[model samples]
Target chain A: MNDPEIKRRGLMLVLSSPSGAGKTTLSRLLLADDPNITMSVSATTRKPRPGEEEGVDYYFLSTEDFGLKVNRGEFLEHAKVFDNYYGTPRGPVEEALSDGRDVLFDIDWQGTQQLMESAEDDLVRVFILPPSGQELEMRLKKRAQDPPEVVASRMAKASDEISHYTDYDYIIVNEDVDMSLARLKSILTAERLKRKRQVGLSNFVRGLQQAL
Target chain B: MNDPEIKRRGLMLVLSSPSGAGKTTLSRLLLADDPNITMSVSATTRKPRPGEEEGVDYYFLSTEDFGLKVNRGEFLEHAKVFDNYYGTPRGPVEEALSDGRDVLFDIDWQGTQQLMESAEDDLVRVFILPPSGQELEMRLKKRAQDPPEVVASRMAKASDEISHYTDYDYIIVNEDVDMSLARLKSILTAERLKRKRQVGLSNFVRGLQQAL
Candidate 1:
């Protein structure tokens, strides 16, 4: 099924969902299940927390170095959340792509837009939605990451995020976790088959023409 | 997971390929495995062959009836191939769609373009590509349906068909039948999850807001 003989360019599998819609969980499942894909390690100016590896975790960078790379157009999309700068470096991603491994993106709609603008053909966007508002609120409340007031604001933000649903190539109403994971895998499988991503196709077609 | 409660709109899963690329085989696999999809039946001016059941195989029509339907704009896409008229009838497809059943189209690029123009959002086009020109010609010759001259013309036509690779949303290289079928099913699975196709999403979202 992997089609080892034919080389394929990697895809930027961008996954965007509201705080409680379980996109992070889906990303983890995809990474664990598929050997052909890996997490897109981000470059960050913020200090790495304990139990984090340098290359394996975040590519921890000095603030000055991060800013310089941003200026040099090395980062695909850079953003300042509060004081810390987090960005995706384009070089490693491109290298991985040519090496026939896909890079998974866990980002919001804004980062997806930037990626699309830069590499429209390389990107596939999927937006996850909770089956119901009640279910969404219930999940958020269960997470207990924020206070009630914060949860209210998070719900508002979720609506704002869901408004951009049309912008994504696919949407999954994640009612059941297992089913959602299956759908995500299917998307990845199908995206790998895109003609533009298969760099060996033109040559292969020509070879077919010559064979007969 | 089939969300039965949500009356989802069906997708027009169009599979296109150059002659001898095995789209028909793939389509059969898809239909046999999935009960949610059915073949798109066409109305034609040409008489049906032996064992061709009306309504199941095709909607048989007289020349006058075909012309009247054409004038009434009943066809999704129609072409005058040689002297006979063949076209996909719109009503049955739409009815099947609203009833939560998908319609599959096995066609070439020209018909796909017409479907895209008329219902871009509803149609999901996947092009099947042979693994190699060598493989393509070998498959054609193996079929033994045409003479050498006919095969040469078909090979030329295949080259012309492959040129329109960029037009398709997805492409599957039929290097292995099982893998290619898996990719095709994956495409259908993902396309079914599109937010626009899930007509009940807005109402579900609104319900979520109200529950909050």
Candidate 2:
């Protein structure tokens, strides 16, 4: 809205929440409201769906190519599950950052960890939390009413995700969608102004010094 | 204006700038706009001005009493300059912090460094930069067309202040006052959400986990 671009490098705004905690909805609202940020398109070994575009949806990759890229450390972070590999490639993220346009990441806690390992300072992690466990279960049940054991496993997974909440830079308890989105926007606004993220900072400081 | 009370510990928002960079104006605007935050009333050995009240303006102190308090580790950070003592007390700050009421600090880089040493995690440092050296000088001249050497000394002091700009967690170039205040508000909002600052967070997390 302000559109005050001082020519700074962007951040990896990693949003991680348990499946029913409204992470996707929050991400959508953020991208819709702000033109300065863009979703980070990831590469995947799985075949693209019919409607999905190559760059728009996913950078669809062959298993061999994925493996080769992993070997070369081209991906910022990657994971292997079942028969396919999915990872955020380093190239496009770096390109977006240097252009002073932020990249939004909708990744799990493990992926967030990997990103942090690779690029610690560039990443701003915000963990989304459900208001209550009952609300979380209700949302999950609406999606699918599974057997007791399955429900137990889902709870276990949610617990696992919640355990990593402290690993994030900020936390947003999703009591209301609008409020959560507003908080996310505030976090983004604040992170953008961090001194290290401003690529033009050194030069800007130098100019100020010369005038003094 | 939105007094959404999700009780949490507050942060020490330290604002530093060179003399001509408009720190006082930004501080006054922020204080006027936000009721949830209050100025960090410092303890001083200097005499209070005519309109100033004892506790509200400053906790007026004698030289001996100030030295005793310093010895007792009561002040978070304090300094002596030209026979006058000024310090932020640890007790009052801690009380305000636990009650979810933020404290604003308008201090120089030296005071900031001392505060950082004592309460590193609780502090958020923001440095305001003037638009240009020329602008800074013009403002200084307007304040008083002092001798050339005095002007030179002021510029040198400003340069020293600017050199520590990198030491802050965030930087705001005061090109526009309203924009800078908006940015400051955003920073405060985001900082309030950090899990560590939210003392009730563990209980909040527990409640969520139990529902799952």
lDDT by residue (B170-208, candidate 1, tens digit) is 878787898888888988888787677888767766766
Clashes of each: 4, 0
The CAPRI-style docking tier of model 2 reads: medium
Candidate 1, position B168, lDDT = 90
Estimate every model's Cα lDDT from 0 to 1.
0.85, 0.89
True contacts kept of 1: 0.68
Candidate 2: C-alpha lDDT: 0.89
Per-residue alpha-carbon lDDT of candidate 2 for residues B28-123, written as tens digits (9 for 90 to 100): 999999998999999999998999999899999999999999999999899888989999989999999878788999999889999989999899
Give the clashing residue pairs of candidate 2, or none.
none
Q: Interface RMSD of every candidate?
A: 2.3, 2.2
